[model samples]
Target chain A: MTTSFPMNAGDVPYSYSKNSHLQREVLDGAKEMMKEVIIEHLDIKNMLSSSNKFYIIDLGCSIGPNTFNSMQHVVQVVKDKYHDNILEFQVFFNDHVNNDFNTLFRSLPVDRSYYASGVPGSFHGRLFPSRSIHVAHCSSAIHWLSKTPKELLDEKSSSWNKGLINYIGASNIEVMNAYVAQFEKDMEMFFNARAEEIVPGGMMVLISPQLSEHLLKFFGSSLLDLVNEGKLDESLVNSFNVPVYFPSIEDMTKVVEKNDCFSIERVELTHPKSKLVDEADAKTLMINLRAVLEGLFINHFGSKIAKEAFTRTILKSDEVSAWMKINYKKACQLFIALKRK
Target chain B: MTTSFPMNAGDVPYSYSKNSHLQREVLDGAKEMMKEVIIEHLDIKNMLSSSNKFYIIDLGCSIGPNTFNSMQHVVQVVKDKYHDNILEFQVFFNDHVNNDFNTLFRSLPVDRSYYASGVPGSFHGRLFPSRSIHVAHCSSAIHWLSKTPKELLDEKSSSWNKGLINYIGASNIEVMNAYVAQFEKDMEMFFNARAEEIVPGGMMVLISPQLSEHLLKFFGSSLLDLVNEGKLDESLVNSFNVPVYFPSIEDMTKVVEKNDCFSIERVELTHPKSKLVDEADAKTLMINLRAVLEGLFINHFGSKIAKEAFTRTILKSDEVSAWMKINYKKACQLFIALKRK
Candidate 1:
C-alpha cells in the first residue's frame, strides 16, 4: 500500500516527540559512524551538483528534535570535509505526507546552518527530481514496509497470519516468506527511487534496527489474551499485520547487489548497548512502541480496542523485560553506506 | 520586526480558508494576465539553471487551497512556455514558521504536476539558495509590513497612531509618513532578497490591494466605541496599530525603480466587481475581515476584546454596506509583474 502510516502527531504525552527516546539513542549511536563514513567515502568535488548546492534528504524523518540534530550533524560533517565553504546545504526533511510536519517545522533549530524544507511523500517512490540529491540519510525508518503484505490478510492464502500481529516468531513458514517477499519488494522500490534521486557518486547512509522477535511476540500475546476473553474479534486480529521488516546483513546486501546502482561501501551491525533490563526500561520501551504503532492499531481496530490492547501490554512489562534479557543478544542495528555508481 | 503574523489557520468558521473568497476572486482575475505576461517575458532558455529544475516559491502561502491553485497555475504557464518538457518543477509553499503547515500538507493536491515542499520563514530575508528560484509569487501578502513601523509604537514619536488601528485614514501626516517609509524599506528588503534567490532572468508576480481607508476607519470606530464607554483602555488602543500598508501605484512603482534589479513588465489596477451593496454582502465582508485581522487584534488586545470589537463591526453591517456603496470606486487591486534583469 502506498498509503502513509504516520506516527502519533503533536506533543501530547503519547506523541512521537515525547516517546522517541529510543530513536534518539539509535541516532546518537550512529553519528560518529556516519561522520567517519562521510569522511572516508564522500567525494566532495564530484558530489557537488552544478548548482553548487548539496541537497541532503532524510527519508522517513518523523517529527523531531532528533531529525533536526541528525541533519545538522550531516551538514557540519560535509562543511568540515569541504573547507572552501563554497557549497550550500539544502536539507530536505522527508516523511509520509500524513506525518506531523507542523511540529517538525516549528521545532527546527532557529540557528540552523542549512536551508530547511519539508518534503511530504512516501520514500518508496520518486520524491525528488532525478539526480538532484547529494546525500541521503535514513535512520530507524527503513524497517517499515510500504504496507503489510496482502497475502497475510487473504484467508485463502497459506501465508495468512491469523491471530497474530506480525510474521516475526510466526509458526507458519509461509507467513514468514510473505513478509520476507514484501520486504524485498519495498527495498527494491526504495533503492530504485534513491538511485534516480541521488547524483552519480552521491552517498546514502542507512541505520536499520533488526526485528526484536520477542517484543512482537509479547505484544501479540496481549491481543491474543483479549481474543480469548471475547473482547476483540479473531477476524480483526487476522486482518491486522504490522508493516515492519528487519533485514539480515545477507538480505540487505543481496538487495543492493540486485539493484546494481549503488556500490556497497560499508556494512556493520552494532547491538544497542542499552537493553530492557528492568521493569522501568520495559515500560519505557512499551510506550515508545505504542507511540510508533498506536496509529496503525487505531486505524485497524479502532481507538478503544487499541487502547485496551496497549494497556494490557503495559501491565505485563515485567514479562517483556524478562524476555528481552534472555534474547537481547540477537537484536542488532544494521549500518549500511552505499555510493551511487 | 522579523516576527511572523500568520493568517487564520485550519478550516474553522473564521479561518482564512473559509474567508478568502475575495482573494480567490482577485487571483481568478489575474490568471489570464499572468499567463499573457509569462508568455511575453519568460526567457525559458536563460531561466533554466544547470540542474534543469525550475524552482517556484509562494511567499506568505497561508494554509492553502488558494496557494495550491496559484502555484499550479504558475507551473502550467511555465510548462506551456517551455515546450521541451525537460524541466522539473519544485514548488515551495512558504509562510511563517508558525503557519499551519500540517493542514497545508494534508490538503495538497495529490496529483500535482510539481514536487511540493513547505518552507517556513519570513520572506523578507534570504529564504532560498542564491540564484536557485526561477519564479516568486506573493499575493495579498506584500502589504503586511515587517512590523508596525517602530515609530508608530513609540509613544514619544509624533507618528504614534493613538486611538487608531492603521495609518490608512490617519489625519496625522507624520503617521502616514512613518507608514510610507516603512513600506519602502520593507519593499527594498523584499526585492534585495529576491534578487539573490531568483535567477537573473526570473520573474516575480505581486498582487496588492490598495489600503481601504474607509474599512480601517469602520473597524477603528468599533474599537473607539468601546473606548468611549469604559469597556476598553485607551492605552491599549494606542498601542495597536495594524501592520498593514497598502501602497498606491506610484508608491509601489517608486520602490521597484529604487530596487533596480527587476524591470517592471506590467502594472494593472482592477476594482473588484462585487461590492458590499447589501447587509448580506457586508456581513460576509466582515467575517472575511475578521479572519484576516483577528490574529493581530487578539495579539494586541485579548481575545475577548477582539471578539467584542468584531461583533460590534458585524452588528453594523447595514452601515458598512451603505459606506461601501459610496466609496467602492476607490477600492482597487494592484497587480505588478517584474522580471529580473
Candidate 2:
C-alpha cells in the first residue's frame, strides 16, 4: 500500500490541480515581478559574455498546467533580452520523488522552446552544480520544511507544540518560538544550498505564504477543535505537526541577511484575487484543505477515522464559512526576488 | 491492449536488458576511441575557453546497465581533462518515447557526478537547442531509419521490394537503390540537425552496423521465409519493412561530406565479443531479436499472428544455429568520430 499519492495529473484524490488556482494567481504575480526585476537589476552584458545556455529551475514544480506558464515566462524574458546572441534555454523542474513526472511530460506545451527535464528530489538541499543556474523560481513550495522539528515532538521541552498541528493561533509563546526556530534552520539551509548553485548576479524569485503578526484568524484550525472536544484522538493531533510555517517578510529578510550570499532586490506582499469568498467557495477551500492533509491524517489514524474527523469537522463548522468571508488578505503572500552577491 | 512493451528494467517481456551486452561491448570500444580522438583532434584549450557546462548526449540511449556506463565514461574523460577548472557535466539521454526511463533512472549509479536528464524522442530530427552540445554518442543505434522509404511501397515502382522485409538478399537493383536513397536522406537529416545543435568544435561518436555488399546471409529473415512458403501472407512480408539499414563506411563518409558540417576524425570497424554462439546461445539471440522486433510485428500483424510466427520460426530453425556459428562478423560494426566544422 502507498502512503502518499503521486500528486500529479489525473490523480484526483491527491493532485495539486484542485488547489492550483491559488498557485496560478501566485505565478501570474510572480511573473510580472520577475520581468520588472530583470529589467532593472539583471546584468545583461555579463550574461551575454559568460552565459550561452540560459538555465532556469522551478524549485518545487509540481505537474504542470501552471509550472509550464512559469517556464514560458522565464524563457520569453531571457530570449527578449538576448535576441542577438543565440542562447539556448534549459529548464529543470523539481519536486519530490513521488510527484507524477509522466503526467507533467504529457502536459508539456506543443510550442515549448526550452529543453525541459524533471529533477526529482527536495529543493532544501543541493540539486544542481555550482554556479549553473541563471534563475530559480519557486511558487508556494518553500514554506514546507524538510521535516517536523524534533522539539515540537518532545514532551519535556517547554517549546513543545502539543495538541497543535500548526502555529496559526498558538497562544503559547514557547510553541510559537519553536516553529519560528525550525523555519530559521530550514530557510538558512535552503539559502546556503542555492547560494552555491546559482551563479553570481543570478536571481531567485520565491512566492510564499505569510501571516500577519496581527490577530490571526486560522483558516483550517477548526479541524483540531474537534480533537479537543474528544471526537478524535488528542494525541494524534499532538504528534502530527505539519512541516510548514507561515513566516513574515521581516523573518525572511533577516534570514537572507544572515545567509549573506544574496541581496534583496524587492519584496512585495499581495493576496490572491479570490481571497475573500462566499459559502460555496468556503466549502471548496475545506475540500481542498482536506485533500492536502488527508494523506498525513490517514497515515497516523487510519483512513476510516481520518475521513470521519474531516467530515464531522467541516460539516459542524459555521465558523469556517464565516471566517472565509472576512478579508483573507489577513493571511497574505510575499514575493521576494533575491540576487546572489 | 498496450501496443509495445516499455523497453525497461524488470519488465521481462520487452526490456532491452538482455541485448544490452552487445551495447556494452560497443560502448567500451567507443570509450577508448573517444579518449584518443579527444587527445589528438580536440583542441582542449578552445573547449576549456568557450565551454563551462561540458554537455554530452547519448542519441539513442536505451534503458541502462549500458547507457549509464557510457555516460560515466564521457563524464570521467571530461573531468580528467579539466581537473583544475570547476567544470560541471550535464548529460542528456535520448531514446524513443516507449523507452523505459524509470528503469534507466533507477539503474543510475549512486556515485554519479554529472547532472543527468532524459530527452524522450527519436534522434532522426532536432532534439536539442542549437550550439548546446559538446559531445554526442550513440551505441548500436542509428541503423534504424526514420521511416520506410515511400518508393518501396509503390506497386508500379521498379524499386518495389516485394516479399522482402529488408534490403538483405534483394535481387532488384532499384529496390537496393531505394533503400540507399532513404538512408542518404535520413543520414543527411541526422547530421544537419546535430550540426545545428552541437558547438562548432564539438564531437559526435556513432557505433553502427555495416553490411558487406555481398549475398546477404540474413540473420533473422527465416520468419519472412515462412511467408515465402505460403504459411503467412506475402503482402504482409512485402509491406512490413524494418526501418533499419546497414551502410558501409564510404556510404557514411559521403553522406557526412554532403552535409558539410562535420569532419571525420576516425572510423573503425569492429565486432562485438562472443558474436558466434552454439544452439543454446542462438536461442538467446532469437529471443533478443523477438523482443526488439515484437512491436513492429504486432503492428503489422495482430499480436496472435506475430507471436505464432516468432514461435514457429525460431523453433523450426536448425539453420539459424548454423548461421550464427559462421563468424557473424561478416555483418560488421562501424565506429565513426566526427568533429563539428
Among all candidates shown, the one with the greatest lDDT: 1
- Which ten residues in a row are the worst by lDDT in model 1 chain A? A271-280
For each candidate in the order shown, give its overall lDDT on alpha carbons: 0.85, 0.71
* lDDT (Cα, tens digit) per residue for candidate 2, span B1-341: 11223343455764577655545655665677778887677665675475466778998787787888888887887777667777778788787665766566656677888877777666777887778788899877777777788778676778788767777777988877878888898888898889988888888888874532221234235556666677777767667666677878888888999999999999978764544332325555556666666777777878877787778666744666666457465645788899998
Tens digit per residue, CA lDDT, model 2, A124-188: 77777777788999987777767777778788888677766767666778877877887898788
Candidate 1 lDDT over B8-106, as tens digits, reads 989999999888876776677788889999999988686674567888999998987789999999999888878776878889999889898988998
lDDT of 1 by residue, A190-290 (tens): 99999998999999999987634447777788889999999988999998888888888899999999999999999999876554332238888888889
Query: Could you give the DockQ of candidate 1?
Result: 0.76
What DockQ does each listed candidate score? 0.76, 0.34
Instruction: Give each model a TM-score.
Output: 0.95, 0.85
